[model samples]
Target: MYQKKLVGVFGDPVDDNPSVVIEQVAFDYMKLPMEYLTIQVKKGDLQAAIEGLRAMNFTGINITMPHKIDVLQYLDYVADDAKIMGAVNTIYVKDGKLYGENTDGKGFMRNLRNGNVPTKGKNVVLLGAGGVARAISVELANAGVKHITVVNVIKEEGERLVELLNSKTSVEATFVFWDHKYSVPDKTDIVVNATPIGFVNKEEKPNIVYESIHPQMVVCDVIPNNMNTLFLEEAKKIGCKTFHGMQMLVNQGAIAFELWTGLEAPVQVMLEALAKVYGD
Candidate 1:
């Protein structure tokens, strides 16, 4: 019998991330001799964790929050997409060389497309300027989003991402200050919350003006833990189409699975696994 391939995800406190169950479902469905695990490795020990993966001949490992950007320091090389996003969420080793890539953006796009949500020539208002926002913006630009308005509380990070998007992709990118008066543009086709506010704090209000959301618009929140986030709930109440955060997590995990195995991802199976875990 062939030995099992070893793969895992690493984060500061990875116990709660759904990638653990999602990837394991994929492996079992394919009947592949693979073991997927969740490892809790804080930022301080990132280098050691990565080194240990290399030493143990790990097939690949996924990097999560806090470590996504910092883990880049220990990689042998990073893909261009990951470089543009300024983070790495997937890493694979070959010939003793560690290669890093970011599939978060691609996964988001896949999820959107799979759900019949359109991106090409669409005006997107992306909330937050963090890692996930960076990935989403770049991928949207590459996928031919007509224009993008990025809103964030931090001026520096928002402007920095806009600059990167403008310089690297053909999409027209602009930064908007996120404040109390902020409202989703009426012409906007998609609104995305890449921030963590709604999930962590249930009482936290939705970032965009709930009244401004239209029936034609699609609202997405990248908070995986709570699928029916306040943002999505308000969007639904306002007749706007909504997407759950778990879809992003599953799609990204599927992309990582494919990257590691070089086989088509069992997307539906992964989705079922996510629904089972999240109870949606």
Candidate 2:
């Protein structure tokens, strides 16, 4: 019998609640001798946790919020996408080298395409200008998205993302104010909720009125805890196509699993895992 390799996600709040999708992928689908674990590490203790992983010969680790960018400094090498996004969501040890990669962008794009949500020549409104948002903007641009409008609570953060996208791709990117009382653009092809508005404990939701969303437009919220967020629920009521953050998590987790194991990811296994955990 092969020795079971160990992989898991690491973050402050994630220790006790590792992603169910990840666990399902490892235990049910991949069928590899691997056990998924979650490690909670506060900002100050991140370095110690990473060191401990290295010492314990962990095959790979997924870095989540509050640690994604901070973990980069300790990595041996970072992939271009992670460096550009200033975030590292996935890390793997191979041939005595630590490699970092950001699959959030690819994962988002995969979910969009899989759902038949148009992107090419579409005007996209991206909420939040943080790490995940940055990656999503880049991917949209690369996928031939016609234009992108970014909105964030902080004006400067949104502007920075716009500048980065403009410098990196020809896609027209702009920043807009997220007015709580205003309506979303009717011409917007897609609206992506990339903020932590619907995250666990952070129950604050986006202010966009669901009735303003048109059937021609698609709404995507990057919160995975619940398959149907208030954002998605409202979009559904408006007859608009919708996507949850679960797809992003699954695609990215699968990509990370492949990177670590060099085997095709058991997508069905991962999907079932996520469904069981999140009640999808």
| lDDT by residue (tens digit), candidate 1, 117-227 | 878899999989988899989888888899999999999999999999999889999999886658888899999988888676776755566888899999888888777
Q: Write the per-residue lDDT of candidate 2 for residues 1-280, one digit (tens) a residue.
A: 5666788888866433535446545655545777877777789998898887777888988888889999999889998767877889889998777888989998888898888777789999898998889998988888899999998888888899999988878799988877564467888999999998878744566877666779888889888677788778888888888888887888888788888889877776676677677754
TM-score, predicted candidate 2 vs. hidden true structure: 0.87
- Candidate 2 — what's its lDDT? 0.81
Once fitted onto the true fold, the runs of candidate 1 whose alpha carbons sit more than 4 angstroms away are: 1-3, 42-45
- TM-score, prediction 1: 0.90
Predicted candidate 2: what Cα RMSD to the true structure?
2.7
Q: What is the lDDT of residue 166 in candidate 1?
A: 90
Model 2 steric clash pairs:
4-33
**Number of clashes in model 2?**
1
How high is each candidate's TM-score?
0.90, 0.87
